[model samples]
Target chain A: MTKKVLVLPGDGIGPEIVGQATRVLDALIENHGLDVTYESALVGGSSYDAHETPLTDEVLAQAKDADAILLGAVGGPKWEQYDISVRPEKALLKLRSELELFGNLRPAILYKQLADASSLKPELVSDLDVLIVRELTGGIYFGQPRGIRTLENGERQGYNTYVYSESEVERIAHVAFKAAMLRDKRVCSVDKANVLEATELWREVMDRVSKEYPEVELTHMYVDNAAMQLVRAPKQFDVMVTGNMFGDILSDCAAMLTGSIGMLPSASLDANGKGMYEPIHGSAPDIAGQNKANPLATILSVSMLLRHSFGEAELADKIDQAVSTVLDQGLRTADIHTDGDKLVSTTEMGDAVLAALA
Target chain B: MTKKVLVLPGDGIGPEIVGQATRVLDALIENHGLDVTYESALVGGSSYDAHETPLTDEVLAQAKDADAILLGAVGGPKWEQYDISVRPEKALLKLRSELELFGNLRPAILYKQLADASSLKPELVSDLDVLIVRELTGGIYFGQPRGIRTLENGERQGYNTYVYSESEVERIAHVAFKAAMLRDKRVCSVDKANVLEATELWREVMDRVSKEYPEVELTHMYVDNAAMQLVRAPKQFDVMVTGNMFGDILSDCAAMLTGSIGMLPSASLDANGKGMYEPIHGSAPDIAGQNKANPLATILSVSMLLRHSFGEAELADKIDQAVSTVLDQGLRTADIHTDGDKLVSTTEMGDAVLAALA
Candidate 1:
């Protein structure tokens, strides 16, 4: 069975990075005999420019029909002036809700070679690997009864509901426990149960779901303590699962902790193992086409896409190993480069990864 | 005129640390001509044991009548088995609501002498001072229509409302801007306005509030970016203002950035400048009565009480300078102690500060 991949080179440096990533994918298909076929499509600012909308119905139909999607990045100053409905970021929200991509997996892995890049002491973040599983589609972001309203006293008030059902918690909890089983077998569920009733139920559902995964240990922490612990001692965690908003905040915080945001990849998954993969870094509009952007994160997104969506673990391992080997060879992009390391251009770095793969 | 100060020495190591803080207060009264009178009351586990309630009506009335309150931590494992209503923490929540303490000022300051204690590189957190003004009384934590209900499909749904009125935002924004006026005059209002409507109104009210404080510079950041920036470059901020939940998380994150939680103090202020001061650290039941706990944070809380509530700037500065002088003398408690520093007992640290004051 051939897995169909949709490559969305969104805006700014998207095309350059995704171009490098597809080169590696081409190698995997040609040399490694990986059974996957991919096609390119426009979305975000590019789509808005070409089709008058951030995401056209045709591109969305293509996305829904694909087995996995590889995204470069979206939104830039070019799209900032547009109304919120037609903005480049709308494409992402549309795809997420339309495809029901609820589970977001953000991995923060700090390679030992780039330990000095972190604001934290080397001991704190060196070789740090923490996977944050976030519920993406639901929670406060999409909850109803959300907007500004005028009160009887003529004062205006704003409100949003943070809501989650048992099934929602159960599904995300299973995703986290399954992920933990593959790694350290420990899941720290982050919530504010002591204060928020919504998270209190979230905690109960997590406890109920943990019975099915007896081999995996589960613990609960308040969000504030979790934030402090991330700074004080982040290594104490393996997999941290939380609601949509918490996941958004904690995942970013964890990514920054690695101090090499250019090397992180993320995945938004659906129930049936289909996912959209992308680098955690945003499109670098200022450095776009200058060959200064880092493509390693985008290349790694291909690895995640293969491992998660297609179950091609061996091919994914090869891609990950190629990345590690390139880093071991002291190949650095401008963002992660130091005086002693070789600063390679985006394409050259991608070539190095492809060469290592070969 | 004499000012009445209500002192509440709560559970675990609270009495020991508050005892030390009061010693400095006594010195200020007798030697420095500080016209203040003090009274003590039991709270938390002690109050629970004495009156079967964490906060008695008499004590609550005393707290209301006092010009300022100095507290030395709360909660311990002994009261964990009790129902949530009678729990020691309930007493603190009761005070915040009853006193209308809407503005929570949490300062994360890393003394240069103790910069080595931080997990971050010394250069990043040395002399770092960030005041987080959290709207204590409102937002998602206290929002209405929050509970878990069984749905039509027999699945339970948990929901909490995140809400803010214009006046609520105005008051907290004024708190941030006013505090900024006293400091570096920069306020960064953090919210999730792009997603949550409540925070959209929050941002709008903040912008409207900034007009009154012409000298202060106001900026906006998403809560997620604020969390990352706190870890990446914390010194770039002077004062940060947000709703209850964001403040609860970011303030703790900022506190941990200093890597010396034992030395951070916090103040909860009402609109009228009356406030309650306490250390950010909790009562360590394990280290209770061991003479090993650090009293610096509690002593610093006394300094905050004087400065915020009594307008005794000179006395507060004297206490602050004395604490600095004591730290300069190489005195250390067990928590912030490293290999080469002078390790002193709780009482000895207090005596040293008192001597420095003299």
Candidate 2:
């Protein structure tokens, strides 16, 4: 009984980097006797080109049945001309909507090997690891009555709602609290409660959720102060749960704390335990098919998929160790290749990681 | 006829710092023959204690009738225990609602003397100045249908609608464009149009607004990307305009880029050009009445009031030069007293700045 996994090698450098990840997946299945089946599908700009649509029903059907989905970077300059609904980036929004992927897990881990990559002092960046559990399905991103309207006076108005139901906040709060229970047993809920009525309710829901996890320490911080603290002392955070827009902005800031887009991976999860894993970086259409794409992020996405979706914690640890080992050995892709001696092509870097695993 | 000005020196070191600014304002009137009138008031915990309300009707009336208002700071641990609506922070929010202050101007300027205060390298922070024109009145802050409600399933729901009519966006766009014309003549309109519908309208309105400022180079960026870029290369930005929430967050980030919070000042303007000036830093309750508080921010606030509301550009420049001269003379307050041998008390620092004017 092989566990079915869907690999969506999306637009731009998506295929190139995911190709390397797939090689590692195959190696895992062969060496570890893991029961797994990999299925490849086109998404984003590639899907738009193949079928004249960003995401077709045929692909969605395949995706719904898979145990977990691993997506590479999506969108490129080629699809920027498309209408909003059919744009390559729309594919990602569509997938998340259809799949009900509500929980977004963005881990900001500062690898010791790339300490020089960060803008902060080496002492501040080293040994920094914090998990941000962002509520994705609700909040401003999908709030209703959102759009542009042409007024009677010939003025165009733009508006978006920041709406959150109790269940919405409660469900995500549980995700963060449960995550904290597994890790450092601390959860800091970030919101603009003092200014936002929605966030006030968000705080209330978080208060109720915290009662369920008495063992976990819960703290609250305003989003602006949280932004400052992230730069001031990132290591102070354990697991932070926040709304969609703040989550999106802060997660990107957290990623920069790691110093390179080539090192971060994210996970979007739903209530049924199903998950979608992807790297935080976008498709570098400029360097597509050149074997110059950084594959470490995609490989880390696979690592997240194993631990978060399949419950293979040991296997996930091995993959993470392999990445660290490769870095320690001075193998680097173009993005992380600071010193000339550490330079390695995408495939060679991927191979080094695999060899490190051995 | 002398113009009336109300000074609300609320909690922490507010009173001590604001005292210096008021003294400077008096000196301008006495020595420079400027017509002015001033009244000092309390509006935070101190107000709650003496006047029984954070902002009494008498204080509100004075603020309404005054040509300009200068606020020192508000909120402290003493007021955090009050109910959310009645908290010290709400006093500030209530004033904004009453005054109809629609445009918030925060200028991030790295003074040559304090360039080393920034986390970034001196080269990155030196001579960097950016004006963030944030819409203060509209968007999520005052939008309708906001708060918590009970659903059919007996579950509580919380929501906030972020509504912006075309006219609202137009007003803020005009503010940004006009400010850009006065400065570097470029504006980057930031929103999340790709995902949020409200932002789509925001973008559309900006598109229409751009036609009016044909000479101004207009560009659009998602808020998340804008936050990253602000940290990456803040010097590249001239003027940035965005919705209330994004502006609130981004301006704070920009403020920290120069690394000295005590040197920053902000101005909120109304439709009729009535303005309120305030320092970006809150009341430091820890240092209150200790003569250790920084008066530079309060002085800077007066500078903004002179330039934005009174149209006294030369007077504003003189005030700015005085503060810069004080910095060059190695006068540092407690919070920013990192530079050895430059530390000076609140009154002494004010005297140094005023003497620099001579």
Candidate 3:
């Protein structure tokens, strides 16, 4: 039962949140009979400041050796002027590429306690759970010939390729279909098949993969229509699968569904069973030391890591129920606060979840 | 002061809603001393059923000859299985490509009375006005090498190109800047500049364009973050510009900000002086003949066409004021109905707007 975890608490509030998640990990070991080993490394702005590089080979090697990697948020306004190759955000790109973590699972769930925090109607935002399976490592974002070039007449054109091989489509489709089998047993593969050849190939591959999962009902939607439908009626969707670029944008939009950004977590998985779990939010440099930044997203990431990567389903459920219990008890973080609500600091909120777990 | 207008009630609820808009236009000519001419033509599924082509040469000729074009919604399930070359959606694409309508302006405004239809908080969705100026002619949607091709390895890889020439970026930037100057004087250029070269060029061109209009505060946002911000804090934006595909997707997401889908309208302006106006919603075939579809969006499009293309500023303002007056009268379309709310049918709602105008 020994499990090795690499923690990359990149910058800003990362260390504080990771510190709390580590404490919860220790509790799992002490009380739940789970054997755990933990290691910490610097990345993003922290790594850039320390070693003049966002990601060093030594840290990358450690990350590869670990069974799972948990990331605190990365990048800040201070690192915004850095060169693209050495930018703090590039550290994430490098980690994702090097690990070949092709499947990004972002679950947008509306917790009952934070329903009022949503811009959406309470009835629409309440008890809604959606999983977005974004094919992370391929398509337009990484395709070749992707730069500015001068034409013969001194004019310039910027170009990027959107290319998808069958293997790329097949592997990601398999991930999405497998995820659908575990959820509501319905999968909607979103693409601009009518317009883009890449999406057509993606759709064909998805169709081929879907046959293996006969229990899941499959549907297709164009990206534009999907965007409209997401607002028009999001309740119709169960599990949505799409390519890297589309997923990156849509997943962010979908996160807004739950009203508060502090309640969401994401997991990116690779072939041969390695996974990276992290909060979808970034380093809030403005609130770095104020204890005002919400830690619930990071806590939820830890819960996802426990269940998804470690296969500790019961422990995962316990963490989730603890989060619900804390909210129900009216322990509000600043981000989810309302009139007459009890507002707690970051550490206090973390402590409340821990207490609820007991 | 004679002006000619072309009306293409494409399909589904196209004729139903466009008919109401035409009545408004007729009223403008008869009651307001505005000289106007209306011409009808075929496009979308209706044309496909009659002529075996969505946009025939005759229809294209009519669109080209007219001073302005008013398009109702296009496409439906009946035409969903058609070939890519002759599909109903292709008709709209062909018109844009043929007309070189490069700047698409999608205005998302939540009417005071219809605020309850939105999933967002009423206060957040009310009195909102944001315009997304999407570049229409270039980028992924119409870029070269955009179809399925065979690879040498006997496997197929789907391919699409996202190319943005300097002039292309410059023209669209000009459109957005000019539009912003007419509004609240802030412009955000959205792109994946960190990842794609075309977006880098797009950002660069926008940077140069911003220098020309020192009065407008120009900002840059990565498309992913921008997507999230659109939902997180939509009020912070005034005018947003991006490439064709990103515009297509993000504009729809932005439209959801108003919570009233049927109340939004759009304009696609070709800088050389021609433009097309339409409701952002599609042909709801299910509600096609039921007198339940909302016509406010179409009526609003006419207002936009008058102001933006025809330069009838006072006339446009009058139309907007009239629409607002009707909403204030508690006249609700079925789509905007709440429990115990007074509701009116499509024609009756149009009558209310006309009454307010009088």
User: What Cα-based lDDT does every candidate model obtain?
Assistant: 0.94, 0.86, 0.86
Who wins the lDDT comparison? 1
| lDDT, residue A190, model 3 | 94
Whichever of 1 and 3 has more DockQ, that candidate is 1
Which ten contiguous residues of candidate 1 chain B have the minimum total lDDT? B304-313
Per TM-score, the best of the predicted structures is: 1
lDDT of 1 at B124: 94
> Per-residue lDDT of B172-291 in model 2, one digit per residue for the tens?
898889778877899999998878877788888888999999999999999988877876678999999999989988888788778889889998988766788999988988888889
lDDT of 3 by residue, B1-358 (tens): 6778889999999998898899889889989977779899999999999999999999999888888999999998999888978989889988988888989999978776777776677777677788999998889988887777778987889999999899999988988998898789999999998789889989999999899999999999999888778776777899999999999898988887787788888999887656999998899998888888889999999999888878787888899998999887778889887777678888898888888877
Q: How well is each residue in A1-358 modelled by candidate 2, as lDDT tens digits?
A: 6788999999889998999899889889999776789899999889999998888999899889998999998898898898988888887888788999999999999889888777766677787889999999888887887777777888766767788888899889988987788689999999999879889999988998999999999999998888877866788999999999999998888888778888899999887667899999989989998999999999999998888888787888899999999988888888888855478888998889889776
Candidate 3 DockQ vs. native: 0.72
Better of 1 and 2 by lDDT: 1
User: Please, what are the lDDT tens digits per residue for candidate 1 over residues A85-159?
Assistant: 999989999999999999999998888888999999999999898999999999999998999999999999999
Question: Which residue pairs in model 2 clash with each other?
Answer: A159-B198
**Predicted candidate 3 versus true structure: per-residue lDDT over A1-358, tens digit per residue:** 6889999988888887777777777777788777778899999999999999999999999989998999999888899898878989888988999999999999988887787776677777687788899989889988986788899889999999999999889888877887777679999999999789899999998998899999999999988778767665677889999999999888887888778877888999887557899998888888887887777787888788877778777888888888898889888877789888899988888888888876
Instruction: Say which docking band candidate 2 falls in.
Output: medium
